[model samples]
Target: MNTLKQGDAVPNFTAKDEQGNTISLSDYKGKKLVVFFYPKASTPGCTVEACNLRDNYEVLQDQGYELLGVSADSAKRQANFKNKYEFPFPLLADEDKTVINAFGVWGPKKFMGKEYEGIHRMTFLINEKGVVERVIEKVKTKDHAAQILA
Candidate 1:
């Protein structure tokens, strides 16, 4: 798989949202997209990052950016998280890691002195033209929204 870089066209993907609604990248061709990949739903770090996005959602909208979160979680879990936090954005259930692998965010990670392979908390800022504008690799879970907004 090719690692995407700035100016590279984001790989097109279709995923089911928490509500089981199918969302395709092509559907948002003319809008800026902030697509973030997290490890799981309802986990500590993931929850904080998601809530941060919720708290800053208004500002993000004001800036004309659309947010979409992805994880190798089930639709049920995503729905529960969305309902619990009242997130204003959709979270895609990438149960098979299709989107995660396509974006090169699925790889080795170190946790508690152990090495394992999983989604590396990462965010991609895609431009209106579908090209990657920037990548946030060293994401801070608690201040994720601020990191992206910065």
Candidate 2:
């Protein structure tokens, strides 16, 4: 999966959000941003990671970071998951894998005894200038906020 690394320019993308609204990377220009990719919405690990971010949303904002969650799910499913969890941030319905592939987070994944291709759980911390400051590849789902903050 040729994942992006720190110091790389975050690829600009325009994708539909849970509400079917157009969200573009340029919208976050001049702001620190956190773009996270997950395999699916409403799954156990995804839930933990999302909720951790949601719960710590204010603190992250206080630190000048805006959060965005992305997954290869449809808009309807993404909306349902966001509503069900009351997430404060927008969830990108990246069904076409525009953002995912741009970030190079979609690739082979292992589950149980099977191997399949999917979105890897990854997060990119982008600076105000749209350059990646850090890349969190080993995400601790339950303690994701702490990991980001640390």
Candidate 3:
């Protein structure tokens, strides 16, 4: 996949969140945003990454970062994951891959030698002007918050 790189302008995407409320990149205008894309909702690695952000939600906010999680799961599954973990951020149910394709994270992935097309786990740090300030492709799921902060 030709994933987005630093300094790229993020596409203004509108998608339904876990609660079915429409969210757009414009909603985060004038604020620094952390848009994390994971493969699935409530999966092992995805959980760790999301929980790490949840555990550091306050610190991230203190540093002026608003977090948004994205996955190609259905709205019902997204809702379960959010409620089960009590995540403080909205998890986009990108069932149509609108946001996922906009970010260019949907591509081939391999697990145990089985290759399949899936969403790549990555994070983008966007500046107030909707430009990507950083792209963390090799995410440290256990220490993701620190990775972003670093």
Using lDDT as the measure, which candidate wins? 3
| Minimal lDDT window, size 10, model 3 | 1-10
What tens-digit string does per-residue lDDT give for candidate 1 at 19-133? Answer: 9999989988999999998999999999999999999999888888999999999999999999999999999999988788778888877999999888888899999999999
Q: Which stretches of candidate 3 lie over 4 Å from their true place?
A: none
The estimated TM-scores of all candidates read 0.95, 0.98, 0.99
Query: Which tens-of-lDDT digit does each residue in 50-146 have in candidate 3?
Result: 9999999999999999999999999999999999999999999999999999999999889999999999999999999999999999999999999
Pairs in steric clash, model 3: none
How close is each model in CA RMSD to the real structure? 1.2, 0.6, 0.6
Error of 3 at 94 (Å): 0.1
User: Can you rank all candidates by lDDT, best first?
Assistant: 3, 2, 1
Cα lDDT for residue 133, candidate 3: 99
What digit string (tens of lDDT, one per residue) describes model 2 on residues 21-132? Answer: 9999999999999999998899999999999999999999999999999999999999999999999999999998999989999999899999999999999999999999
